[model samples]
Target: MKRTVFIIWLLACVCTVRMDNFTYSYKDAMRCKEHICRHGYSYETFYRVDANEMRSINVDPHSVFEMHIAIQAASNGHIVLSEIPNPGVSDPVYEIVVGGGGNKFTELRRNLRRNAKSSVTTPQILSPIELRGFYIKISEDGLVEFGREGQALPLISFNDVDPLSVKYFSFAAWNGVEAKFLYDCPIPGDTSIEDIPNSHPEEPKLTPTDKLKRTLLMGRLPSVPPNPVMEVKLGFKLTSFRYNTLDSKLTTTAAVVVSWEDDSMAWNPDKFNGTTNIKLRQGQIWKPSFYVLNSDGYGAMDSTNPDTISLASSGEATLHFQTQTQNYCFDTTTTYSRWPHDVYQCLIVIEPWEAHENIKIEILDETDAKFEMFSDIDTVIHNEWQIMTEQVTLDSAMWNEIIDLINSEEVLNTHLSDKMIITVDLAKNPDLYNLVFYVPMLVVLYVTVLFGLMTAVMANVLLISNFGEALGKSSAMKQVLTCGVVRAVFCLPSMKKAANGDYSVQEDEDSSYIVDSREGVEEMERSDKEIKYGDKAELAVVVDKILFVVYLIVFVGMLAAHY
Candidate 1:
C-alpha cells in the first residue's frame, strides 16, 4: 500500500510537470516574442531550458528562472565562440537574417551582432518554442531569418535560453538540420493582423505633444481698461452774523442778514437731497457774504457791483443789505435867580431827505429842558417831524442877556424860517432849582464840617500834656487817650495832634522810644533776677577785695596831698 501511494504521488507530480509544459498556441506565444523584440530589431535564439514553460510548471506566478546560453555574430557573415568548441568536434551552425522580407533585415542583423559582442557576458536568447510561434525564412542567398508574419522586423533571441536557469525544454535548429518549423498561421481565436496596427502604431506624433508642452510652458492672465475724469466749480457768499454779547464785553447790538444762491447750471439737484441742495446753495451765496462781514463792521452798509455776483454750476440766487440805528435818553437841567424868567420850549426836527428802508435817531442833553414830545404820525410817515412844545421857566434878571438875544428879531426871524416853535410860562417852583443843584453841595459841606470838628477834638486830646495823668486817674480816660493817640499817629493823620507839649517836638524821636524802652526794661528785669553765686561768688569777692585795696591806696595818696 505504501509503494502504491508513493507511485501515485510521483505519477501525479509527473502529470503536473507535463501539463505545465503544454505548448501555448502560436498566437498566445507571440506575446513573449513581442516582449523580447521590443529590445531591438533583431536577436539570436537558442534551444536550452525554457523560462516561459517554467512559469507554468512552478504554479508560482513570480518565478524567475533563467538559463545561461551564449550567442555570437560578426559584422562579416561568421560566428565566434568565447570558449573553443570541442577540438575536432563538429558544432551545430546556423545562419539568421533579422527582419527578413523587410528592408530592415540587414540593419537589424548588424545591430544585434554589435550589441551582443559589447555585453559583459552575452545575454541568453529564449528559443522560438518558448515563444509559441515564429517564422523562419530561407532566401535564395542561403540567409535564414526569424519573424512573425506582417512584422516589419524579425524577432530573434539573444541567447540559447534565459542564461540564468532553465525550467523546460526549448529548441534551436541548424540551418541545414531537419527540425519542425512553426508559423503563426491564422487561427479562429487569433486577432486580425489589421487590428494590431490599430492597437499600436509608430510612436505617437510629437506635434500635438509639443503643442501641449508649449501651452503649459507659457501661462494664463487677465485684462484691464480705461476710466473717466471729473470737473468741479465753486461759489461763495455770507449767511448771517450771530451777535453774542452776554458773555462778551460788547456795548452794542446789531444783526447782519445775508442770503445767497448757486447759479451753476451744471449742478445736478437730483444728485443731492432737497434739504442738502438748499443748504449747499445757501452756503455758496453766504460764504462770500460772511467774508465781506469779516472784512467790515456789522452795521457797514455798501453796494456790491451786480457783475461781481458769480454763478456756480448749481442754479440759485442771493441778495444782502444792511442798516443800523441806536436809541438812548439823557437828562438836562438848569437854574435861575430872579423873576420875569423867560423859558423857551423849542421843537427841533430832523429827518432823512431820501427815503430809507429803516431809520434810527438819538438825542443828548445837559439841561432840564422840559418839553412835550411825541412822534407826529403823519409827519414821520412823510419823513418829516418836529420837537414838540412845553412851558419852561427862566429868571429874566439872571438870564437877561439870554432873554434879550432870544427876543431879537434876527433870532425870531431865523426860527420862523426854519419852522422852529418856542413858548414860555411863569416859573412854578423856583426852589426846585436850588434843591436840584445846591442840596447835594450843602450836604457835602455839612459832612466836611462835622469831620473837621471831630478831627479838632481828637487833635486837642492828643496834644494835652496831662493826657497820661488823666489816663492814670481813670481807666476810662486812659483808654480814650491811648485810642486817640493811636488814631492820630497811625490811623488818621488828619487827626494828628498840634504842637503842644515836648511830645510834639519829640514825636519823630518818640516813635522809636516805645520799642527801645520796652526792650531796656525787659533786659534790666532779666539781669536783676538772674545773677549767680557759688565758686563764682568767691571769685567775684576776691575781685572786689582787690578793687577795694586799689581804692584804699588811691584814698591814702589823696590824703597825703591834702596834708
Candidate 2:
C-alpha cells in the first residue's frame, strides 16, 4: 500500500509538454487570407509557460514530422506538405501529396468512407483502412511511413526521398475541403514517437509475454493510462534582509536553494530527478519573478532553458530572484502631508508545485521579509503644552507583536491560499500646530485680551449712561492714551464731503415758501446737532476697530497654546 501511494503521488508531480496542432479546413483558410499563418507564410512555433518565458521547438534539416490527418467529405482538394522558396511561385517545389485514387504517385480508393467501413478493416498501399483519415510520418533520411490513424503499425514504408531539396517545411492545401491535422510533439526536447509514449505513461505496463498474449487475443494495445495526478509544493521565501530603497521603489532579493544526496553520495539537481525547468505558482497581486543568476554555471531559471537550476559541482544550487515594489517609500493608501497617519504591509512571495519522483525542494524566508510604514503623523506629537514635537515615539513592543503575527505560519498559509494583500488603513486627523515663535507677540496677545474686555465693558456703560457727549469725547481721546502715536493720528476723522445734494432739492420744492423758510431755519439748527452726533459714530467705529483687532490677536495666541 505504501508503494502504491508513492507511485500515485509521484505520477501527480509530472509535468508534460504541450502539443501544438496545425489544422487545415474551410473556415480556417478564409481567416488566413493569404494562405499564411499570422502574417508570415509559416509560423515560428513556440509555447508560453509564463508571462516572461516561452519555449520554442528546435527543428532542423534532420527533424522528422508525424501527425494524424483527416478529411470531412470527399472533395477535389488535396493535403500538401512542401518547401517553397517563394510562396507564390509555382516553380517545381519539393513536396509530398496525399489524395484519393486518381493520383499517380500513391493510389487511394475514390470513396474513402466505403473502404473504412468494409469488413476487412485492414490498411493497404492503395487503400488505407480509414476512409477519411490516415497516419503519416516523414524522416530526414527520405523515409515516409503511412498507415491508418488507429492501426498498430505502419502499413507501408517508402524510402529514398531527399530532404535537401526543400529549405523550410510548411503545411498548405489547395481547393476546398474540411480537414483536421496537428503535430504530436508536446515538450520542447521530445522529437520521436517513442519519446512521447514513454514520458507520458498513461496506463499500467504489462510484461512482454503478457502483452504479446493480449495483442494475439485483442489485436491491439490499451490506449489510456491507469492513473493521473498533479503535484505541487508549499511556498517560497525571501532569504536576504538587506533591502534597497531607490526613489519610490523598494527592492529585496531572495533565492531558492535545493539539495539532495545520491547513491554515490554526490549532491546535485539531476541526482534528484531535477530538470532545468522549475515550475512555480505565485499570487496574482505579486510582481512577476525576476531571475537573479546571470547566464553561467548550471543554467539559471532565467536561461533560455527554464527547465533547471543547477550548481557547478557544488553540493547545492541557488535560484535567485528579486522583487521591486513601486511607491514603497509611502503607503499606497496615504501620501505625505495628505493624511495624519498610515500603516502598510507589502508582501513578496513565491511557491512551487508539489514534489514527485523523489524530487524534494526547500523554501527560505531568512529576512522575515516585512517592514512597517509610518509618516510624520507617527513622529510628531502634540505635547501637554500643546506643542507638536518629534520627541514622541510609539511602543516598540506593539510593532514587534504585529510583525510576529505577520510571520506566523497560519498567516503565511492564509496568504498563499488566497490573493496577496497590500493594505493601508485610513489616517487619523493630527493635532493642528501654532506658528507663534516670539515672546513679545505672546505677551502682547495676552494684554490685548484684558484691555479689550475692559474697553468693551466701558463702551457698553457709555451706551446706556446718558453721559453720551462725555463718553464720545473720551472715546476719541482714549486713542492717544493707547500708545501708538501714528495709529492715533490715522484714527482722526476727516469732514470728507457732507452726505450729498438731497437737502438742496428739499429746500427748492417747499410748497409754503414763507412758512417753509421759517421752519427751514429751525431744521438747519437740528441738522447741525445731528452732524455732531455723527462724529460720535465715527469715534465708536474707531474704538470698535481697536477692540476687533485686539480680539483677533488674543484668539490666535490662545488657540496656539491649546494646540
Candidate 3:
C-alpha cells in the first residue's frame, strides 16, 4: 500500500510541474486577406528576457539565452522574413508570444516595413508550444527545420513561379544573454553615373599683332641693317724700297683710275661734292682694279670692290719715305741682274697713302747718277700698299769670295759703298703711296757663313794656345816619360825592387868585389837622375811629334768625309 501511495504522489508531482511552453496557431492568429499575394510574419516576434523569466523557462545557468526562427517556403510560393536564421540578441529575456495579451507582435510587423516593402500578417502558432525555446538548423539542401522533430521545409521554392525570381528574407532572435548575427552579400561592380556632354569648348587662335606685342614686351627686336660699302684703289708702281737689314724706306706711284658709283646710279664726280638741290644726297664711293705681273709675265687684276679714295686737292702729288736704322743685307746683283744661276728673290712693298698727282722718284749717288721717270703703267691702284717681288742672278764666284772674306778670322775694313746699291725712280702721279723691301736669300746665306766661320776659328785658336802652354811645362813632360818607362819595365825585378823597397850596393876587399843583387837598384837610380835633365830637352820634340800626327789624322778624316 506504501509503494502504491508513492506512485500516486509521483504522478501528481509530474502533473503539477509547470509546462511553461506555449503554442502558435496559424489559423487563429493569421488571416490571408488576398490570394496570390506575398505574405510574412513580423520580424520583432523575437525578444530578450531577464534571468528570472529565463529560469522560469528552464534555461541553463550561465548559458547564452537566444531566440531562434525557422522559415520555409509554402507550396506554390515561399515565406519571406525580415531577419534570417539568427539575428541580434541582448540581455533581458523578452517574449515572442503570437496572439498573446501584448501587442508586441503587431508592433514588430509595423517595423518590418522599414527594412522591406512587402506586407506582413501577425505570426501564427503552428504547434502547442509556439513560443518555446527557439532552435533552428539549416542543411546543405537549403532546407530549414525547427526543434528536434526535424520538420523539413524549403527556404526557397519556384513552383508555378518564375525560376529567376529570388526570395530574400531575414529573421532575428532576442534573448536575455549576449549573442550576435552577421549579414553578408557579394560586392557589387562599380556603376557610378557620370555627367552628360556639352560642358566644355575649344579655345581661339592667336593673331600676328598679338605675336609682335609678345616679342616686344619680352625685350626682343628685329635684326640690324646690312654693312655699308667701302671704296679703294688698285694697280701701282712700287719702287725706291730697300731693306738695309730689317729697316725700310720706300715710294710708290699709282695712276688715278676712277670708276665709282653711288646710290644715284651716276659715276662718282671728279672729287667729293656736296649735293645739288634736286640730287639726292649720297656718300662718296670708288672702286679701282689694278693688275699685278708674275715672273712668267702673266698678269692678274685685283680690286677693292667697295672702298673710297680721294685726294686732298686734285693736283700732282708725291709720297716720301723714311724709317729707323736697322741691321740688314742687300744684293743688287741677285735682284736686278738677269743671271740664271742667281736663284735669290727680293720682296718690295708699298704701304697705303692718300691720293696724289705727278709722283716723281730720283735715284741719288756719289757720282750724282739719277734715274727719274713717271709711272705710266695703267694697272696700279688698289687698297693699301702691299709686298711685290723681283728676281735676279749673281756672279757665283764673286759671291763665294766675299762670303769667304767675311768668314776669315782676320779683321775686315769695308764700307757700305764697297757693297752694292740699287736705285729706283717713281714719277709723280695723282695717286702716290708707301713701299717696303725684303732681303734676298743670297744675302742671308752670306751672313750665316760668316758667323759659322768666325765661331770655328775662335775655337781652333783657343785649343792651340792651351796646347802650347801644356808643352812648355817641364815637370809635366818628365812625368809623361817616366810613366812610359815604368810601363815598359813593369815585370823586371829591378822595377819591383825600386817600387817596393830601398837598396844599397857594397864593395869588399877581394879584388874590389861589386854586390849588385838588389832587384832594380841600378836602373831606378839612373832613371831618377837622367829624367830631370832630359825632361826639358825631350819635351819639345815629343809635343811636336804628337801635334804632327794629330794633324795628319785630322786631315785624312776630313778628306774621307768630303769624299
Candidate number of the best TM-score: 2
Per-model RMSD to reference: 48.2, 23.5, 44.7
Candidate 2 segments exceeding 4 Å error: 1-307, 320-340, 345-563
Candidate 1, overall lDDT? 0.29
Clashes of each: 35, 17, 58
Candidate 2: Cα lDDT at 446: 72
Q: Give candidate 3 regions above 4 Å deviation.
A: 1-288, 295-299, 303-306, 313-343, 346-541, 548-563
| Full-model lDDT, candidate 2 | 0.34
lDDT of 1 at 505: 19
* Residue 360 displacement in candidate 2 (angstroms): 14
- Top-lDDT candidate index: 2
Q: How close is candidate 3 to the true structure, as a TM-score?
A: 0.16
lDDT of 1 by residue, 1-563 (tens): 99999999999987864443324455444433221221122223322333344333332234343111111111111221211112112422333332222212321222223433111111112123342223333232333344433344545433332122221112223332222322222322445553111111123234433333233224322111011111111111112112212221111111222222323223443433322222222222222211121122333233332222233334433232232222221212331232213222212112212221111211211121111111111112111111222322222233344546767642321110111111211123445555765677567557755665565455445434465234345655334434545335333211233233211212354365342455665664554355321222222233344445655675567556433
Query: How close to the true structure is residue 533 of candidate 1, measured as C-alpha lDDT?
Result: 18
